[model samples]
Target: MPRHDGGEKPQRSCLACRETRDRDRLIRFVLSPQGEVVPDLDAKLPGRGAYTCIDAACLAAAVKQRQFGRAFKREVAVPTPDEMTAQVAKLLLERVMGYIALANKAGKIVAGGSMVGDALKSKNKPGLVLVARDVSEAIGEKIAAQAAGNNVPCRWVLTKDDFGALLGKAPRSAIGIKSSGFVVQLLKTIERYRNFLGEVQ
Candidate 1:
């Protein structure tokens, strides 16, 4: 008997914005036979997929800089900046929100300081830590130390209010975890480091 299984999803980064957001957080475009840039919202379209962040600013920059050509390694024509940005942003937001819902269902995320602290103390230290800015600096430092000692990455530690609003919920009164904020920050840092690379260049 034949068996069926869902395949693993691969990730790609946006060249223009240098954002390492998940594939879902970015829009995919492919060059059509007519050499027109076509949006591949499903990310299942045939041919090479070039990425751009969902934000209007990043999308505009990507188009202006011909980043799609760099991504596909071929000259291609794209839609108007405003139109493409709107469409891409809408799709990306929906996809990102869906992923968040799935993660919530899987019980992969946690909030609140005391609970998170206990989680860190457990044998299974959390792979990520999200510290709310509202939390005292002393407490934040302590948690950061614990995470560092456990060899876990400290990420997306922002005010609970900010994170909660993004998720369309009442204040979680904590931080965000396994979030794109960490990815964006990491990408920015990498870009800065790369810029200084071979300064002898």
Candidate 2:
């Protein structure tokens, strides 16, 4: 049943944590047409779906307990936890890149060092700043300071080439995620990726 409070998205319980949360905040999995378990990050796969919290701990629990079989009400082939983590990380990275591309098209992103710096100095600061992992420490520090002054989160996880490919430009050293609807989801996705990799607690 839909939420009586009329929440925008329905809630689902994580098979591992058994805690209910907004569906978008949980990662969905489903039995593929070929009878294999697969992550459905976009939630568009046609089949009975199971969900787990985006944390690696939850995923580990799910795998250790063989919860997928119970969730799907059948025997399902479960991948090793490491393999599943890699798959989720890959899908999350793709989702983040897609969000960046969409935000760029929507004029909600500022790419390149000069533009991002200008954005940081402006009164209307970006909500999130991303520095290329390969950027020099000095440059990255400068950008991080600016973002901190603006009370924004600065991330340095993706490579310069990754940002460039997503923005359809030359390799970018820095980028800013301006205020937009994508900011929340993008941040959540990034956090989930970090959590999955045990980078964050």
Candidate 3:
């Protein structure tokens, strides 16, 4: 069946670029009989399928290693590394994004530092804070205090500066000066951290 203009949008994320794109723009693959790997251009398959972006290098990485083996928990022979990478990237992207969607739907998110502060003031603030590692110390401290005062735990998002780079447009500003811009996907990230902390506690 042909998809209409308003029909479902097929999406896939690139492992190499850490970007989400339309599924049609990517390649799909499935583990075939006799351990041979097969590309599922039509996306119809009986067993598990994976996807990868058009990056040949990433495809190479996927095939030379245990990427698919770990994902599927079985040693399925791949004719080419490229085939394995496509399926692994696709499966990983979907798995990650699906959890994000679930967190969003559960209202476990609060984006923007100012908005987060407001949530602190509100009756229901988050139980955890995910501050960017590159965020200014003064700003980070203040946010930390708010979380601490509320009995919320504060954690740096990651050790690498890439976390800040990946934050896109999230602002670095004085607390009372102006509002930090909103990021849709960041809410899911923060919520995931919150859940992670909950599990540890």
Best TM-score among the predictions, by candidate number: 2
Candidate 3 accuracy as lDDT: 0.54
True-structure RMSD for candidate 3: 12.6
The lDDT of each candidate is 0.61, 0.86, 0.54
Sort by TM-score, top down from the best: 2, 1, 3
Worst 10 residues of 1 by lDDT: 192-201
Q: Candidate 2: deviation at residue 173, Å?
A: 1.7
- Give the TM-score of each candidate: 0.47, 0.82, 0.34
Instruction: Encode model 1's per-residue lDDT on 1-201: one tens digit a residue.
Output: 133347634566776768676676566788999888887866798997887664566667788888888777887878777777766555544544444445455565666666667777787665566566576777778777777777766643335675466556666544324444443443343232222221112
Better of 2 and 3 by lDDT: 2
lDDT of 2 at 50: 94
